[model samples]
Target: MPKRKADSVLEGVPKLPRDSSIAHHTQADYIEVNSFVTATPCDHCLDSGVPCMIDRSRRYSKCASCTRASRVCKREFYTGREWDLLRRAEDKLSSDIEKNEDELDLLEPELSALQSRLTELY
Candidate 1:
């Protein structure tokens, strides 16, 4: 393929110095942008069923909704795989609880009989 010509608009702009403060500021800006991009909604926003909109101007801050409501912003960002694992664990626990409840129900008559015998002895 033939070489492409550079944009005229960018030709006049001077290259940034490697060790300059401007470069450092640019790095910091990148960090801020990455944080904003990767950040998930806070717990309150998730529970309230609202969109999590973080203020681009503020770094490491609460979502706009939480800020407006004056609520504590607690974030727990979980990946899709992590959420799936958590849900699976919860389902297992729920199944165990149901089994235990059924066992308890089956033992209720026996428990009543034992109590009645104890009462007679008393």
Candidate 2:
């Protein structure tokens, strides 16, 4: 990500160092759905001293509070396995669409043949 020139200029201004104690935890939606939360670092990228809060959920071990602290600490982060699962789902959907198309094509000809036979009988 590119920082705007105006934002870059602000860095020249003298500023007090951040106080890390008051930072809160954060959550990552992408990670939490697939993996269990552990005593990972805070998800939120705070000043540095913030600690992650604990979550006991079986699906998501970490709470939203920690998600805010650090991206690396996010409990809900996805692994390679989740990405593989997504790819598999997309493949299955594509296969199903192809199968339905084939079925439709077969049915259309059968329907036309049946109509023609009825007309001849009449």
Best by TM-score: 1
Stretches of model 1 off by over 4 angstroms after superposition:
1-76
- Residue 46, model 2: lDDT of 38
Question: Residue 18 in model 2: shift from native, Å?
Answer: 18
TM-score between model 2 and native: 0.39
lDDT of candidate 1 over 1-122, digit per residue (tens): 32445655467688865555554455444444544442466787678786676656665366655544556778877978899999999999999999999999999999999999999999
Model 2, CA-based lDDT? 0.56
Candidate 2 per-residue lDDT over residues 1-122, each given as its tens digit: 32887777787687753544223321344334434433334446233545444444444444444444443444445557887999999999999999999999999999999999999999
Which residue pairs clash within candidate 1?
none
Worst 10 residues of 2 by lDDT: 21-30
After superposition on all CA atoms, how large is the RMSD of candidate 2?
Answer: 11.8
How far is 17's C-alpha from truth in model 2 (Å)? 20
**What RMSD does model 1 have?**
15.6
Question: For each candidate, what TM-score against the reference?
Answer: 0.42, 0.39
Q: Give the winner by lDDT.
A: 1
